[model samples]
Target: MSTSFLLFFALAGSVVAQNFWFSFGDSYTQTGFLDNEALPSVANPFGNPPFPGFTATGGPNWIDFDTTTHNNSLVFTYNYAFGGATIDANLVAPFEPTVLSVTDQVNQFLQTVASKPASTPWTSENSLFSIWIGINDLGNSYFLSDNRTSFDTTLLDAEFALVQQLVSTHSSLFDVGARNFLFLNVPPTDRSPLMLAEPASAQAMLKANILDFNSQLVEFAENFKASNAGVTTLIWDSNTAFNTILDDPTAFGFIDAVSFGTGPGFFWINTLHTTSPANVFWAEGVADVLEGTIF
Candidate 1:
């Protein structure tokens, strides 16, 4: 086992139970967990294929690392992320028709876990809801003929609208006491191997779209927190975290920033996705946020 895994186990004496994590996102966060599958248990919190479930990173993704390795407390993770999910299919179609969008994921949560069922008993105080979407939404539309500015606005409007629905008084989650929320911004995908192969102008456009989307996301999060009472909101700036590694890959123990391979030193595992080490860094950062251990 890795040192981090051993460290997590060693800290079991301080583990606090009943801390639930409801995660929703795309490939970067997917862990192939199904609601009907074997539910999470103390021995195996993820409770599906195995410890490091099917992931796009070629190993464990951020959700897997956060739940098992980086977490300070024992958290039962219910990940509803799919491989090609967008914010909403109506606004931005996924790579596959069968893929469930973030909207679909939220609806799934409402139907299955929102009511505080007997099988997965979760309370608002002990549970946290997180969404790390918009990668596909912007990637699918950034190069399209549609007006980029207007389309980005439409995407975020729909995104925050769903957030509103979750926190609304009439919503199932609100009635069942669901308060904590964490929103992760889109990472610096323009620096990915796929985008590195693109033209300079194309790369610039994609970067601009990412920055705009992330800026609006912060605004929405601030507004949501200001307007909602008794709600805890956090925005994890994943873009900066990815850029920090990309800027100095060797500092993070990566051989280089632009390489793509299924190896320890490579920063990326594929053209568009990062390696498990990169995901581990992300998980550690998020764990710090959740544990209030970072400034």
Candidate 2:
């Protein structure tokens, strides 16, 4: 091609490369799974890989979109998971009155969103948002704080309220007019190293609460669908799969002790992560769900 023609094509290509994928949650959805350039390897041991550090290759993460599909597409996914983040971490202005007593991460998300998110670049047509938060709301309340029953009672209401708030308030970005989205409800945070280290006696309660939380999530998705016909959004149940991993580490080629670790014959070596192969497994499932449910 002529130089002028090439230059014009290059400029046009850059314009089309602005599509985005936004992620909200903890390590389950962040660059934690992939080798994003910005992650801290020292604090996050599994950020790197072959399985113990950050990398340019996109670590083993579910939110890591298809590079081929996203190539020249400018697909930017945001990792809104704050380290040690939780639900209701900050319930005030720095944090908005969130649905769940979740955390600063959620508050920060609300903060970053424009009062008028319906603005230009934030248009829904050019973006896809994947939200996988909420487990921390219940998990932290139950495990870290030692108040399972009471938290569970209050949390479901909070989870429902949060979902409703997100769906109703963020209609512009989520519904996207004719465009739609995928909402990932709570992945199993209880399976993380923080909770897995608990005594076996605590395991049953931990697993049960996760199920209860996931049930509420499913209910919210279904309820939203029934109530709003115009919303094209759908739910991707990462919660089920993540729970599977936690319940039986060996299923996903993991051997967990205090955390997701590597030893003897296991592939997962980090406290809260799996190897590239495992990460790929989860990502494939997410891709399939998107393909089957959304677009």
Candidate 3:
């Protein structure tokens, strides 16, 4: 976290309602758009049934918290995340061909702007756009021979380019009046249940890669902020948040964060996903960050 973020957190509550929230990323941030056939609009902003959408975190993920509990009546939610998504088509393909890649998700939003009925009331000033991706990118990249430099040039560099693509294309988003942006760095994947099962050396290597990816992401966020005046951008320290609880689950209110057993209420429900309790904590942190930056 930066001193700037700390300052933002201290004064975020005053931000006026965003009214609309847009999310894009992989399964961790995904809310099963394909499963619900959801669209971004006022009447049915979530989907047909208006459920939380299927999430690996067991139940209502971060977006759920943002839209349901934290948001006011004026706010609406539209999640465009899919399981197994990557920043671009180069990393991992979606689980199914129809699942939207991060790029695809953003393009879909652009299409919505271009085609929505004139009466539709989405304005960039009243919306918040968030992206939580890059897990699969690093997860797939780390074990490919353990060479750090190779990982940076091939995987990290490519990921940075994708970030640049999203931010620099502000014209499309900014043209439509979207000003608030939130970028989540990759979490501590080495602490996840599956990574815990790996050997210590393997964990160390993967951890190093995650740190490098996050460092580069921070750089991108800073650059985007400096160049794009009037756009509010905040990079949530997901790595720190995840590692804090992993270090002391009880401190964060988890009954047993270390125990990744079968059943609900554990830190992780499977080799890769966590339960809603953890997601709720993350969502809270994100809400703070949003308030800090936009309000």
Candidate 4:
């Protein structure tokens, strides 16, 4: 084999040997992979119900695409995202009480995977923990008559508090040797079909809140990295990605950017969620971030 081909195989082998991704978020990132269900294996990476699992996109969501399509390695994804999760149910309740919040998901991770059990042995160097929340937290509270700016502060405080808990040395993911983290900021939900139908002022308010949250999120991540030693952090700007596709749907193979349907032509599957094709683009973007091709 040529030198270039040999290098490719070497890198591929390293990736295939060890790559575990732990995902946490809401509807946008949910894949319905339960701990009680079947565990992830090489034969069936996603486990449980199948490749796509139960998703909001009407097909495979970003998690599925990331694992199967964008990944150059054999990645076993352990997803703990619920459909209507918020940062904290006490702060902003989910659509249902049973829906797991970010707090609950982290708790679940501690209870089940913190010990690095034999069934899923993952190391700090080989595993990645990703969290993509804040959409529901902001969406459910942005329209409240209460002081919106103060609410955003309160929400991020609670959200980052949980993040601190996760990285703390006592009984947490960091204690279990997980050092890599990828935090995805809230996407442009204000441009979704649901928000588009709202009054222009309402849409503008939501967009403002999103921008505020994303800016604060960046500051928090920078501070977090500064405080924590031996930890790697990455922030993916899903907002910009959403806007890029929405601005030019044709460039991304979508017939309509402002419509919702089950067909591939529509960017969204419902009033609030994007279609699988859109998520494919998201997965690709995430892959780029992971490969260090983009910041």
| Top-lDDT structure, candidate number | 1
- For model 1, give the RMSD to the true fold: 3.1
Candidate rank order under lDDT:
1, 4, 3, 2
RMSD of each: 3.1, 8.6, 6.1, 3.9
> Per-residue lDDT tens digits of candidate 1, residues 1-295?
1224335445756654556888889998998888878877677787676878889898888888877767556678889888899999988899889999999998888778788778788886778889999898888888884467677778888887777766665453347456799999999898889889999888889999999889888888888889888878888889999999899999999999898999779889998999887888888788767765211
Clashing pairs in 4: none
- Over the full model, what C-alpha lDDT does candidate 2 score relative to the true structure? 0.48
- lDDT by residue for model 2 (1-295), tens: 0112123235744543344444555545544333233321222222222232232223444444342231233344445543333444542111224322234444444555423254224554555555565555555544554555455546555544544454455445443232345666665655656556777657666677777766666666567667765555667777676656657767665564234443453434565455555565566666666553322
lDDT of 3: 0.68
Report model 4's TM-score to 2 decimal places: 0.90
Clashing pairs in 3: 12-291, 15-295, 124-177, 124-178
Clashes of 2: 21
Instruction: Please give each candidate's TM-score.
Output: 0.91, 0.62, 0.80, 0.90
- The TM-score between candidate 2 and the true structure equals 0.62
